[model samples]
Target: MNFYDFKFVFYLAISWCNLLEVDGITVAEQLKDVLMEGYDSSIRPVNNERDILIINISMNTMSVLTLDPAEETINFSSEFILQWKDEFLFWNKSDYNITWLKLKESFLWTPDTTVSTSIDTNYLIDASERYVSVKHDGTVRQSIYAVFTNLCDMNVDKFPYDQQTCMIKMGPWSYTTQEVTCIVGRDIAPNDTDFGDFHGNSEWDFEGIVSSVGETEDPDVNFTFSEVHFALTVKRRPQFYVWVLLIPTYIITVVCIFGLFTPTANHGLREERVNLGITTLLSSAVILQIVANAMPKTSELPLLGNFILAEIFVVAIGVLFAVLVLTLHQRAHTREWRPPAWMLWILRMTGSSKFLSRNITKIRHKSSTAERIHYTGEGAYLFKNLDESLQSVREYIQEEDRDYFRELTYVKFFDRLDFLLLFIFQVGNALVTLFLVKQ
Candidate 1:
């Protein structure tokens, strides 16, 4: 045959072979036949008596809905991926191009521990369809998307500045470690891409997540079962409490301090100062009640609780100081009462002459000198008569002495006490605020 004739023959043979077409359809049919042979959907795909089924588990947290410290529960949405090998679904990819099948159409068996241990079943909020993927080696991976409200033991001792660890536990319902094992799947960490889409929770911020696997002993069944645990770490966002509860309480407590400096000359002003102190104290109590209502009842006190207690103590001191000042004023006006000698010395040493009313100290000094002279019988008598004139002059001297004492007594003591208490409060409040905030 010539070159042209040989080329024609080759082309004809290639076309004939293409017409026969013995690849995809025939291979798929043969694979299906082999896969169906003696395959039982109800039985687990364990090859021999010693074979054990292993399920790889992983999760991708989608969003955090709520974290209720009072309820000791966390609500979140996540996608759980579980992968296992099924010998019945095995097929050579080179022979057949079928890489996966829909889970509804497949006859694969699944584990009983499909749901999380802490899942709230009554409110079943999962809204995802069951989807599966297959590998050439017969490994099947199924994904389940669920919204879970799970029980978590929260330690809220630091509340509002606290970090909490909440866990999602998954384990087999009836299978022991001997028959099946749950392992952490490869590449099973939280997806950072999903974090940007996280539902904004006003009270908490999502920190991160950790995954681990271990076996737990069931005493009732006398068996150890494998479980997969995922821990989600979240931090409490404290700005809300700082502004609403803490700042207001602190401001009210500090305002109570000013009541101590109110003027004692006017009884009405003194009464107003006392009333202001009482009002501030009641405001602090109301704030404390609000904080208490927000938190769960527990024996251990939270940091916020400690701060509220300190605020209450400070305000109570202010109220007591106000009452003491009022009592001193009333006593000075109604009756004569001398301060102890030691107290007088301390008051004189710490007293600021600049803060006192002009000429008040000079008047006090002159009064003191005149009283000493009168008691020593050094002052001249106004009249010569022994009984009648002496008695009349003595009555006038006593009336002047009483008026002088009333003018100097309460006002002087109150000024000194106000300065001392202000210093104490400023230092004490600073320390308390710093300690509580750092904690």
Candidate 2:
């Protein structure tokens, strides 16, 4: 074989292989080539440059990952359905021998739809391995699984009882309103029966959705962009906070209140009543910090925060009352020190005398009603002088005996004051709670 004969033989073999049909030459095989003939993916598939191409957008929620209160964002998985008429992608069914075609996403012109309010500020997470559906009538339908974190202007004013409305703000990134119009959410989750397909978040309840189509004016470019907003409202399930924060804090506050005032004396000695108040106050403060840490560092405080503050206030006030109690008990050691008239009256009126310690009750004033009131008052100075003068004549009225009487009188006074303050603390706590919860 000469050199020219060898070249002709190689060319003949290549030409024969091209005609041997590596793939079947059916209409399905040739449809893509004919559709792409002189096709431009960058150009909008419209008859006129100024004609508005209408895109219908809708979504079905697959699952919600979370509604992050601190980040002010929602993470969810969704299936977005987009449909539009592509004037350039159509063909005659008689010639193609097929009513529809599934072409690679790369083979067709698609809208550059972006999430305007997304934290990432990126286009939707379209299916990387998706096919664009084309009917003989030029209708294009595309669906993709999109998972994203969208910015939601969360108003947690009511906190656990709050419902937040967040939107998926979608729009053509480069197309003006004159070139495109979007219709959104009008037919969302059409097959969703009783939300059977929706996998909900454990911390939130998925409320219904609303949608609107509007134009967004960009002053910098002096043009209006078409926008579609699908707003979804979610309500918080407050049971978690109620259990972890509210119930525990309330129980702790009540326990601290009782620990502060309820007389549990050991052998006539005051126990660690002051320590109880201060310690519980610090614990409540720590709990408050926990609640704060769980939330974003916002200036406005939540209702739960206010409720914890009120608990701390009550505990602090209890501490103050505890200090007052110790002061009264200390001052009683002075022979001239006497409990005030109101303190004496409280003990008699509220029947809080029964709450006195076993040792205090044993030595408490006991006699006729008239003499009981008079003696419990710690008497005038002349009376003390009379008792001292009588001490010399009656050795039975010893100095230690007089001291015991004075100690008993003031200890009873301090106990009565504690009871009164406990009542005040409960009332104040209730009022503060009502106000915070109502807001």
Candidate 1, residues 1-439, lDDT tens digits: the string is 9999999999997876565446644444555567768877678888874688999887754477888777888888777778899876876675556676454424457776645556573323332334466676889887666677888888878876999888778877788898889998532233366433333367777766677887789798699989898877878889999998888777777767765554334544677777777777778778777777777788876899889889878877877877786787676566544455576577773343322222222222223443443322443453323434555577667656656655665576767766777778867877898899898
lDDT computed for candidate 2: 0.74
lDDT by residue for model 2 (1-439), tens = 9999999999997876566435766566677788899999889999888789999987755567788888889887777778999999777897656888988887788998877887652236444567888998899998766677898877876776888888888878998888988987553343356543564589977775677887889898799999888887778889999899888888898888877777544213444877888889889989889878767778887779878988898888888877767666665563345545475675673343333322322222233455322323456666756755564455444444655665565556666666777778777777777787677
> What is the overall TM-score of model 1 with all chains considered together?
0.77
* lDDT at position 411, candidate 2: 59
Give per-residue lDDT, candidate 1, residue 304. 90
C-alpha lDDT of residue 43 in model 1: 81
TM-score of each: 0.77, 0.79
Q: Which residue pairs clash within candidate 2?
A: none
